[model samples]
Target: MSKLAWLNGLPLEEAKAEFLRCCGSTRWAEAMARARPFKTDTAVYSEAGWLWSQTSTEDWREAMAHHPRIGDVSKLRERFKASGAWSEQEQKGVQGAGEDVLQGLADGNREYEERFGFIFLICATGKSAQEILEQLRERIKNPPALELRIAAGEQAQITRIRLEKLLTSP
Candidate 1:
């Protein structure tokens, strides 16, 4: 019994709940649940990509609301408990940084949110805290529209990672 097999076999409500854990947008989760019985892993990933593209800015913002600010480890662990250990794992690179680096990330996150009206989202899986901060500093220079698109793209990458985890988890 593979994870995808388990996912494909889940009841509709349960499937929706699981998908919600992957991406916080209700629309994405609902669309994923309705697109069930995916025969292949690629099909699942394809459906997720298509649905995310079709989603509106409102839906993207909804998903963004689910994440903590970058470097906010306490909030990541305590507030995002619904996502369990995944958030903490994804942000592992920032776990034990010097206060100066953490403070830089924190300040950059604030400036980014003030500019773009959402959290600074990045695929932080393997990025170091300094590298993440550098990316944020550079990205903050983009115009609002461009930055929003970049954030959404980063969220899409995160969605893909979570989906892969779902399929691979025992």
Candidate 2:
């Protein structure tokens, strides 16, 4: 998928397939499928955000589960290999961050899940562990509805990144 895929007049199924290839989720795939025949890349991607807005909280959580926590790189095989893309930036967020902050993040993640029954999702694209931890601490106070919306926005960021990765081979 290149800029050409984003171009208008691509076959409807072809557009839908591209979206699914980027992120293989049922609702999102269908959403992109239904929104097909988009006249511009911005329009297609704009609707992608709208589609995420319509996703159920559970679905969003399922997506978040795909990501590993900061500093825990053992499980994410490919993602870890790609760590070069994120390591320095993410580590800087935790630079000089003591054990207490790490423990607090661990606790916060547990408490947040106990309250919401899902992981606290964030766009870790260029963020360091400390940045993500601090954000988690701040977001813990948010009411459920607000937090869900915030998580949705984060998911949008991740989805957009994945979409770009799928469209661009590097």
RMSD of each: 1.0, 4.5
**Least well predicted 10-residue stretch by lDDT in candidate 1:** 76-85
Error of 2 at 84 (Å): 12
Q: What's the residue-level lDDT of 59 in candidate 1?
A: 94
Per-model TM against the reference: 0.96, 0.68
The count of backbone overlaps in candidate 1 is: 0
List, residue by residue over 1-170, the lDDT tens digit for candidate 2: 55634534456666665565444455786678777666666776788778877788777766665555654443445553433344334334555567877777778888888887677777776676677888998998999999988887876876787665644545
Clashing pairs in 1: none
**lDDT measured at residue 69 in model 1 versus the true structure, 0 to 100:** 81
Candidate 2: give the clashing pairs. 90-128
lDDT of 2 at 8: 40
Off by over 4 Å in 1: none
